[model samples]
Target: MRFTWAQRLTIAAAIAVAPMSAAHAWNESGHRIVARIAWDELTRPQQVFASELLVRHPRFAEDFAARMPPDIAARAADDPERQRWVFMHAAIWPDLLKAEGKRLSERIAALPAGAEKTELERRLADVKRYDNATWHYDNKPILIDPYALPPAAPPGAKPIGVQQALPNALRELDDRNLPAERRAVALAWVLHLLGDSHQPLHAVSLFSARHLPQGDLGGNVFFVVKPRPADPTPVRLHAVWDDMLGTDPKLEAATKRQIVAAFPRSRLKQELAEPADPPAVEAMVNLWLDESYRAADTSVYDANLRAALLAPLPAGATSALPVALDRRYLPAALPVARRRAALAGYRLADCIRRAESRSRP
Candidate 1:
């Protein structure tokens, strides 16, 4: 059966499930697909080493193993697919920590004065320490859209962003001198942060003459709606792209392969060079940021989206009326997202393999 362009756009947006509270991109499905792709690139021995680090994570049993869906849990302990699922789970652990922290808060709230509440409070404190909220994105301001725009106020101090944290995460994974426990934590972070680094919105904030003079806060304030939903509720453009790969809650093996195969390194030859010895850590991260910034300039802030966003705001509101994404936006945007995600996966695999900690089989 044939579908209209509008229908196709709606289909594209509908893949997103409920929006996450975090404005970061590459929602759970995206991160998991990146991890899946990286996992497939690893040899069996490498996979074993990575999986062992995940096992050593402080919350591995509580947050990972116990949370496995029944289908995965039913597999034999040595099943390769099940182990792959662990990698997928590890990739989303940071976001999962957010929800877990929220649950702990609510559970503590409901509990009366007792040892149980005290222990829960301690666990919540631990979650607070473990969560690094600022590391997901680094906004490079786009000061000029079509017309000259006023400069955004200088941020007094540099905000810690993924660009800074990612290299540290890599250093952590590669620093074999660190205890296994610390390496385990870094492994989870690297799995998640690399995928975030590739998202275009995560790399930029648009400063335009009209409604977004202060910048669009990395598209968090860039409101959009699905073409057909005609639903008036405004959704963040950042959240829309977060689910670009699709949003099934669980990552089955078949689904994983489909997403990985959709965007391979061959498709990104122009966007990225063949893997080489990574330069200094900071330089490597800057290269990733450059790819995302370029993606944001062409694909994200394209003519259609800019026109919609720059139009007048609602009479009494700060944001423009939510712009309906047309067929044109998704066509260019989805491919960029897929290509970046696939490259992230491939590059992440390279990082794991070359890390000083990688042991021979």
Candidate 2:
């Protein structure tokens, strides 16, 4: 049976690999960088506003892994069908941004003539705040996909113009009636939307009943490696990428040193200084995501699978899918999740550097 991308994605999860709880630790690393940069650039009030926004919508910091409904996973396992093109609509982040933008435009149009100038200034400040703060969430890490979205298509078909969604969302904000802070929220969401849109599994669907019943639940339920040695519990796929990657204190520190050593402060600063314009940030995030997925498939995933296969079976293993848990598979799969998360972070930082540079006058 020719397994579709969805199947491959799920199968990677089904295998007992890592613990889910710690699978997404790497997420904090990226969010921290973005938050730090935003804090440095904005006014105290603006900083407060950005902080509140992030607090209100913490999902922006990490993939909403646990929130994924069980139904999403059951459907994939039971049917095992390829996902329809429509399922891949730019992730919910972009839609949220579009909604927020409309709200902002509404606020803008209601300004009185006497207040228009002040209002526009406030609105522009809000825009800059977002433009500055959202680089990491919205535009960092360019996605380099071999399969880019198509331009025009049917309602349920995969839309190629996904990249255009954010800019359009921003334009809508430019036309809305949102309060300044709310406008900031909208822009922040737009930043985050770009990141979510680039995550490959976000655009995929899976078989419903052949093996596992649930769909991928945006990959939250699909299990992957957890970095620790003793705890061989399986973690969901989304969580793996969301946090785990190089997040293990030992692993994260080691990886951080390597990235720093290889890229030096000068290089890191230059990379972070890349453009943060709506169009540029969006394009860059897409490019990074594409590259990360490519790496995940070849270097990361392949290595994990090999490790799982090679690890000796624990004491009594009956079936290929053993009731008594497999040791080798668990240890091996754990690293794949960690590696992918690291790559995602790496690409994210790369995109942010480019966006940051672009943001500079």
Candidate 3:
């Protein structure tokens, strides 16, 4: 059965509000798509090496294998295929860790200060150590006004943006000197963050003098509602884009196959032609971020969409209120969202191949 845009949006928004929390970039389906694409492109040895590392993930058995879907569990051909599935789920591990951390903190708060509380606090610290949540998105502020320059960081302040984080993860994946366990963790993050960086919202934040002088926190605070008669509860603009790919794993897998097939063959061939050296890889990542920033500037922060979604502040009106998305907004943005997901998958494959090449003797 076919679903209209409105129906899809309703289902997506409902899912967003339910038990599943929104992720930093493309949601679970999007990340899984990227991982699946990369996995498909990997050579046999590369695949085996990646799986071996992933099998060593500290929580692979408890947090990954145990949570595998019944369908996937039943159909695995062998250990290698199951390992690949585990690696794909690992793409969402950081977000899951966030949720787990929150739950642990709540439990700790409910208990009195005792040995249990102390142990819980220690566990929380352990979770936080691996959290590195900010690594998912660069959040480099972009001024909406063409004439304005990006804000400079204050003296002595250090920011480990996604651009840095992703390359760092790649380095960790390539560094044989690091313990295999440590490298495995880095491999999982590399799988995830490469996908995150391709998401326009994760790469850039929109800044404007009239409404969002400090930036929209990567669209997280920009409230948007579906038209009246539909659910009017305001949702974050980022959340809307994040949910565009839907949440079903089977559907996502099918969509990944379709998107991969539909992607321009010439462009895909050019991207995968030769593994890039480190400097070239950095340049490629910067180029990708620039592309996303331009999309944020033009499409995501389009003046027409903004005007439709937000009412003018009355004379001396201080607070910006949520407004309905323009009828045309989603129709136009959906293709861009799909294109980004496809590009992310392609680039992730390129990166994994590069990492594998560098790791080989």
Name the candidate that leads on lDDT: 1
- TM-score for each prediction? 0.84, 0.39, 0.83
Q: Candidate 1 — worst ten consecutive residues by lDDT sum?
A: 12-21
lDDT of 3: 0.73
Give me the displacement of residue 275 in model 3, in angstroms: 8.3
Residues 1-361, candidate 1: write the lDDT tens digits.
1234454445335424323223567888888888988999898878888887777888888888889999999998668888888988889999888888989999999999999999999999988877878788888888655763646456797667799999999899988788888888998899999998899888888877766665667887666766664554556788778978888755545655765677666766665564467478788888998889999988888777777666665455444435677767776777778788888998888888877345442
**Which candidate leads in TM-score?**
1
Report every candidate's CA lDDT: 0.78, 0.38, 0.73
Higher-lDDT candidate among 2 and 3?
3
- What stretches of model 2 exceed 4 Å from their correct place? 1-30, 37-179, 194-218, 225-228, 245-282, 303-361
RMSD of each: 6.0, 16.5, 6.1
- Candidate 2 structure quality by residue, lDDT tens digits, 179-256: 444443444444444444434444332222322233333344444534345344445555545553334433544554
